[model samples]
Target: MAGFRPRVPAPADITMIAHHSVTLLFDLSDGADLAHDARGRYGRGSVAVGLLPGDFRASGRAGEVLQIRLEPVAAAALLGAPADLSGEAVPLEDVWGRDAAQAEDRLRAAGTWGERFTAARDILTRRLTELTRPDTRPPVDQEVAHAWRRTLGSRGRVRVGSLADEVGWSRKRLSARFSSQLGIAPKRAARLVRFDHAAHLLAAGRTAAGVATESGYVDQPHLHRDVKEFTGLTPAAVATAPWLAIDDLAWPASPPPAPMHQRP
Candidate 1:
């Protein structure tokens, strides 16, 4: 959970790399409509941005927004079907229906960031509690959920085959089940997670060659291809990407006005 109020003049375009989290962005300032984002076309004052299969470009001020990032496994349950979430963003109203308006109202009425955080937490907790009722969305399969955590825990280095073996299922069955439950195939999920870790390594001053080896790429060129495919940028360019520049400070135990990036 974090809050971001852009102080710098918002760029007309920003590059958002694929991440494994589902991002919920609530606009407090009634900013301009978002265009060409993960959702292709999206705007509703607030949105839940999902894990784009690859990097994407977004246009909006990101002005005064509260950000809540959820694990994709948990996201599968909270944000409607994982399939609908991937490759696009969804309006909060789409999932919450009419109650989304009420949540926005409470969020908007908060007096301080503290108040805002409380309001947001309350909303999320309430929704999660509702899912615990007799029937909501079906719970994510335990094996599939375990596979996701294993993928993330290894920084995407774990082999998909091994994951399948561990779960005592054939790769074909595992792939199908994982994709259905998680909104993406296991290999692609690993690639996205790997790319995410490598990008951070680059941003933290590691050489591409080093990152490649450390991140489990076949070689520098392999790393090059994956990075380019994910971000459409060279490893060097990604090293200084504006989105990754202040990452060290972006996530604090208690945040202080960071940028509201929908997985950017």
Candidate 2:
């Protein structure tokens, strides 16, 4: 979870890069407009943004907002419909309905960030627990789960074929299962993960050429195309993104690896 309260006015527009994880944004402000390149505009109070939200932007009003990132496996269980949200951003009300409204109210009533964080955690914990009861959807497949971990650990440099082989499943079978459960193909997931790593490198002042080399891209043009496809922005534009500026604060442990020069 991450909290933000802008001291100054919000940017007129802020480009949001695609990410591998599902994002939940709770707007404690009056309201904000979320415009997705594909889905048009949405008025957000509390929203569930799915994987690869494809070059969206948020504008209007600045106030306390909390964002939570959830892995697809966990989000599938919590939202009760991973496939439905694979590449879309839907209102939280669409998933949780009245429960969503109630949770938002509770969060708004909290006096401090700590209180708000606690309230949000309690709400999500209860929902996750209820969804994972014995009779609910089966737990995420063990092999698929491990594959996801390996992909993340390697920063998406792992091959899907190797992952399938390692997990003792045929490539076709692994792809089908992964898509059904995680709302993304394993190969696509790897690409997204790799793109995420490259994006962070760009944000950290690495040249596009350097990022492409270190992030496993074939060349700078490959990285450029991927970034443009995912974010609708050039690497240079993405480097100065307001959204990415707060990533370190929100996700500190996942910092980009040291520059090549810093390596032994």
The candidate that wins on lDDT is: 2
TM-score result, candidate 2:
0.86
- List the global CA lDDT of all models: 0.74, 0.75
Any runs in candidate 2 off by more than 4 Å, and if so which?
A: 8-12, 30-38, 248-264
Q: Write the per-residue lDDT of candidate 1 for residues 138-233, one digit (tens) a residue.
A: 657778988999999998999989999999989999899888877889999999889888887887778999999999998999999988887788
Checking candidate 1 for backbone clashes, the offending pairs are none
lDDT of 2: 0.75
